[model samples]
Structures are given as C-alpha cells and as structure tokens.
Target: MGVPATVSSTSSTLPWNVHRLPRADGSVFLVTGGNAGIGYFVAEQLSATGATVVLGSRNPAKAENATASIRARIAGARVRTVRLDLADLSSLQSVVESLEVECLDAVVHNAGVALDDPPRSETPDGYELMFGTNHLGHFALTWWLMPLLSAAPAARVVTVGSFAAKSERLDLDDLQSRKGYQPKRTYGRSKLAQMHFGIELDRRLRAVGSTVASVVVHPGGALDSLTPSRPPIHVPTTGARLSAAPAALLVQGKHAGAWPAVRAVLDPAVLGGQLWGPRVFGLRGEPRREPVWNHLADTSVAARLWDASCDLTGVDPGAIPG
Candidate 1:
C-alpha cells in the first residue's frame, strides 16, 4: 500500500509523538554519519532506550568525542564509535570485516554531504565522490554487513533520503556530473538514488525472504550536509537558538527530523515501504507523523534509478544475505 498525496500528514490515527518512540533493548544498531547532525540524535535516543549503538564517523577523534558525549548523557549506555568515511571504500571494507557478522539489529544509512564544491572530485578509488560516497559506498557497506543484520529478528536498514530527491532527473551519462557539475543537481541526484535504492531494497528483501525491512526517511530542513563532491565535516548545530518555534514551529530540527527515522527503525508496527519526514508542508513541522511526499511514488523513474545504482555499485541485489 503506497502512501498517496491525498493522505494528509496530520491524518496519523495514533497522533504519533517522538517522546513516545518504542525501545530497542538488547539489540546492536549501526549508524553512519552518527557523529553529528540528525545521526547524532538518532544514536543518542536509541542508546537512551538501551540499545547497543555502533556509531560511525569519518574522523577517529570526532567519533571518540561523540561516543564519549553519548556515554556522558546516558549513563551505562552501550555506545562505541568506528571510523567510517562514506567517501572512502577502504574504510567501509575494514569496518565491515572487523564487525561481528549477524549482530546488528538495525543499520542507519545516515551519512550525507552537500554544498557547491569544485566541478569534479574523485574518491580514493577514482569514482565520483558524491555518488560514490552518498550511494555506492553506503551500498557496499550495507550489503557487506547484511549478514549481521539478517541474523537479528526483525532487523531494519534505513536510508536517510532527501526531499530534493523527488526533483532530480537521473542523468546516466553524467552520473558524477563529470563534464559540468551543477553542485545542487549532483547532490540532488545522489539523494534520489538513495531513495530509489531504499524502495528497490524493500522489494529485494521480500524476494529473499529476509526478515529485515528496508525503509527510507527524509529528515527535512538543511543540516550542514554536503554532496560527496564536498567534504566530510560536521557543522555545529543551529537548533538551540532556533528550536523555539518557527524553526521548531516552521522548520524541523535535524534532531527532531531524525525522530521519524528512529521510530521507523525501532517501532515494530511500522509498515514496510514507508517514507518518514515532517508534516506541516514540505520540511517545516511535526517530526513524528508520516510526512506526505506524493512525489516518491514515481515507480518507473525509481526503478530506472535503482537499476543504475546497481550498475554503479557492483552489488547484485539478489545475492544480498537473507
């Protein structure tokens, strides 16, 4: 059952609120870009609920600090940090190899980037940074770690997609934006690809009889993320000053934005193929309810985008662990 635009965000029968999100006791969870922004809060809130969290960040120092802060805030919480740069595949491989396969109950594909960077930039492996990091790197990492997720009962894989994804037109010839990169377009396309991958992933999971559910969420509002072509960096949060109203009342806080995603991962009742985000039109309010984005249902384009992502990432969706 796909969500239609006619379904208003406020129509949620449960009147969902973030404070009441369900728990994840005795489970191990993984989150990428968990050092700051929405990912930080996602880890914090999950840890608050007694889940063992393995947060990933690009910088070792930053990862350590973020983990320490989480421990400080939630005494006795099981939280650790691993160095993971989505732009770097070697790090993804090393991290996957080190982890105990089949222990993760959930994996949050939360890392992302933005900003108008130089026309062309490449990953250490010479692939385009934006697509490589935002989609393919995460793609490889998740599949490699699938065995771990499948071992857990009712595990989930959540991709932090973007609303801008609805607007991107897949340009297969210039996926990396090699010839002339339009910063926003490149970033937008990567996001779109992520969303498509999420949708296709859901279908693939069912086919394999995997207990894991693949879900997608758009946090809403800009949180200092850059496209892959940009840098892996965290900017100080802007919510304390803005959390009062319009930002709170109008714009969604990155932390607040993460609530829906967090809920989707932990709440067993969440239906598969769900897309979470803000309710008050676009990205301006209510983080708990189903954010109505009617545009995500363009299955044709989504299927094409999914096919392209598979080609680029080199992972056969069918071969993923059950």
Candidate 2:
C-alpha cells in the first residue's frame, strides 16, 4: 500500500512535548521492523501526527495486522507496508525502488535481531547474523534511500541503539565474531557498531553540508511484561503485568522504550550526532539529550567501522559529494 507524497512542513522552531509529538502533516516516515515491539509504537505515534507511516517488515501478515491496529486506534491514519528483509542484501535496492513516495521525511532504523544463546548464525551474505542485520543492513539501506531523504527539506535518520552496547567494544579484526562468539556479548557489539555508524554518518553528513540529520538513541531497560495491550499483537496478561510491577520501578515497557526514537524523529532542536536516552539513571524516565559514552566517542574506531561496513556491504554511505 502507498500514500501520495507531499511536502513536509516539519519545523524545528516549534515547541516540543515528548508525550505529544509535533504536527507533521504532509510528511512521510519509514519505520523498519515496525510490525511489533517498539517499532510498532513508533509507527502508531507518528501516525497520530498525520504523517504517512511506512512499516518495513519481513512478514506481510504481521505488517497488515500492525497497520490495522494503528488504524483502529487513530482514525484516518495513513500507513503502508513494504517487504523488507535486511538479511538479504541483494533485495534491498528493490525494496527502496518499491516505495512510491518521491521524498522521505525520516526513517527510524529500529529493526534488529538479538540472539540470547546460540550456535552462531550468519545472514544470507555470510556475515554474523547480529552484526549483519543490526549494523550493516541499515547501513546499506541508508545508502540506497539517501536520494529520497535528500529530497526533503530537513530529513532525519533516527537509529535505535541498545543499552547493552554501553559496555561493549568492537574488535575490528573480528567484526564477524568468527573467533569466539558469546551470544550476549556479540549482540551488544553489533549494537555498538550501529551507534558508531550513526555518529560517523552524522559527521559525514555535516562535512558534506547536508540537511539530513542522523541521531542515535537507546531504550533503557524495556520489558514486554510492562508493555500495554495492543491486541492481536502484544497483550500482556494481568498476571504478567502484576509480576512486572516491582520491576517497573526500575525499568519500563516497550511502549515507553519507543520514546527516545520518537523524540529524535520530531524534536527540531535535536542536532545530528546527539545521543538520546532515558533521563533517570540512564534507565527509565522522560527522554533527554545524553552524552555519548566514552567507548562510542572514539572517532578512530568509528572511521574504521565505517570503512569496514562499506567494504562488507559494497556501499559507501559517504559517497555523496561534499
């Protein structure tokens, strides 16, 4: 499904309220992996702003159900779905070509894969599953979608990072995690790579004097148990909510988890290269501009990661003329 493209009147001069998004009438945004979890909520919230929301999902049925849920809650909401499989590198261009919009106001890079425990797996391109999908996939997608993004007056690319990435470091030599793979650690590193990419992308975009902004955000400790019901998608039982009540004091539900990304997308004052996360102890609270972690601030590492990503994906995000 598709909605007609329109000029965006999104302005940074407007006041911002996290609970209530700025009106984005005539804008179009894409939320990868928007079928469920935090992505779903991002789509729902964006839909309320009157922006045409495109949900990128690998499953058609789930995508339709998500769009239906959004329509059910927000009257006259405009939403569409596109088949997107980040793991399959060859198919990405086709996905971008399929989009009917002439310009894209923003894209929330929220789709990711996490492996708790496992015999390590690789994507279709033979890269580690976590690193491949979480980092490289979005990296390539951005490259292909840059044209549409540039068409907008001030486009934003919001990358959803992870709290797990805070303590992790990238091993440039073994980015694929081929040497020794601990599922938890590997997942964290992948997200770390994503953060590095977002920051590096901002640097490149600024160096080229492009209006497109890249912002990174991480949800604190979001648990599904604390999430509100969105029937046919996520419906935590009363018992589950009760069991999670104690933890709610420290953490939050996925719905709240979507806050940082939402703010990054619509907060006009938000500049490129800024990091946004929960305000309270970096765990749970209203979204606030936060400092980049020391590990994530290493420009050398970020540059190397950018080069490695380009080599692996065969796409140079910085290829745009300065």
Identify the leading candidate in terms of lDDT: 2
Question: Could you give candidate 1's per-residue lDDT for residues 44-91 as a string of tens digits?
Answer: 888887778888888777777778778877889899877788887757
Estimate TM-scores for all models.
0.84, 0.95
Pairs of colliding residues, candidate 1: 102-148, 113-226, 113-227, 114-225, 114-226, 114-227, 130-228, 245-249, 246-250
Give candidate 1 regions above 4 Å deviation. Answer: 1-15, 222-249, 288-295, 298-300
State the displacement of the C-alpha of residue 293, model 2, in Å, after optimal TM-score superposition: 1.3
How many steric clashes does model 2 contain? 0
Worst 10 residues of 1 by lDDT: 224-233
lDDT of 2 at 162: 89
Off by over 4 Å in 2: 1-15
Q: Write the per-residue lDDT of candidate 2 for residues 170-256, one digit (tens) a residue.
A: 999999999878999999999999999999999899888877889999989889999989989998999998989999899998888
RMSD after CA superposition, every candidate: 6.3, 3.3
